[model samples]
Target: MKREDLLFLPISINVTNKKILLIGGGKVATHKGTIMARFVQNVTVVSPEFTDEIRKLPFTFIQKEYEKGDLEGYFLVYAVTGNHDLNAQIKADAEELGILTSVCDAPLLCDFVSPAIHKQEHVTISVGTNARDAYQAVAIRNQITNLFENGTLHI
Candidate 1:
């Protein structure tokens, strides 16, 4: 099915105590890791190599290649490895285990898409294009942030 054909439901999930797994150590993976760490207390990142940014994060890091059953105990998974084949395998494994998964740059393989988020105190705004147009989503998020900064939109 096409990405546009799917109807994505917008909802918030509480990952306070959930186990989150990130399979990658590159820039893309680091970005996802940083965002997930903000809400999830139990996050483990597995990768053979990592960028400097990810090394600074407080999450547990397993410096090794992802195995077949890496998604076994995680409630959610983010597959951001540069290798498309590995990412596909990760998605397939996560699905088999009924775990929610998001594969970076591949919306069709993702169970859910991550949105461009803007957070201020208790207010949080998210803009997404169903993984169809990331540029447009970021632009919209920036617009919303500007509105809030200019006091055009009150909290």
Candidate 2:
């Protein structure tokens, strides 16, 4: 997943009114939900178990195992299941419905891969590497941030 592989992706979404479905209630799911809720109106999280982090969120929680039917009528689906098989099935289901989907740690099965992101109001920076050296990308991003801070870079 090089930067080129990222192609065009949404930098920000004002979740004033959007629906997002997050599958799994573990740490990754909670992190994703926190971000999604920052911009979307409704974020529905479906998972049989909820982490303490997840329990703190104010979104709709469906404390049940994921089913194929759970994908109905959602704008986006996130498959972050600890179970790879279930995650793949959710990805397939989203594909069948023509809905956007993100599969964590399974970028090969995703329509979109979440980029390493840095954000400020009205200004967001996203960097994607080949998923080979995430730390390398993070270091580069830090350099870029420093350049901007020193007025040596402009977008």
Candidate 3:
């Protein structure tokens, strides 16, 4: 499969007993980490440096450069490093270990892309543009969130 064949079917993944490894400590990682926290509790972040915002998250933070060994035992990986080369390496390492990886800003290297999501009680809604148009997906998600907030849309 190629990047052009990016047909990411929208589906829900059960992350129970999953250990998520996030390889970044900047703002992007913070955002991703915060989102993951909403759904799961076992997220570990490894980066040489971290943003103040990321440090506030309830996750295990390893203050060191990422290594291939980091992907071991991880169910899912997020290559959110600011360095493109590093993200690519993380993707490669994850693939070698048969772990699903999502590289920030590089959808082609991702096995899956995180979508703009909304959760209300027992209802959850996610919007995405096949990892090709994140801005549009976020816009649509915000609109849906507004509708739900004002009672214009119901589950």
Q: Highest lDDT: give the candidate number.
A: 3
Worst 10 residues of 3 by lDDT: 1-10
Query: Which residue segments of model 1 deviate by more than 4 Å?
Result: none
User: Model 2, 74-125: lDDT tens per residue?
Assistant: 8888998788999999998899998889888875676766656666566678
Instruction: Give the number of the best model, judged by TM-score.
Output: 3
Worst 10 residues of 1 by lDDT: 32-41
Cα-based lDDT for every prediction: 0.88, 0.78, 0.91
Cα misplacement distance, residue 147 of candidate 1 (Å): 1.3
Writing each residue's lDDT as its tens digit, candidate 3 over 1-155 gives 55567989899999998999999998999999989888887999999999998888888989999989988999999999899999999999889999999999998888999999999888889998988788999999999999998999988
Candidate 2 off by > 4 Å: 1-16, 130-133, 144-155
Better of 1 and 3 by TM-score: 3
Q: lDDT at 37 for candidate 3?
A: 84
**Pairs in steric clash, model 3:** none
Residues 126-147 of candidate 1: C-alpha lDDT, one tens digit per residue: 9988788989988999999999
- lDDT score of model 2? 0.78
Model 1, 47: alpha-carbon shift in Å? 0.4
TM-score of each: 0.94, 0.78, 0.95
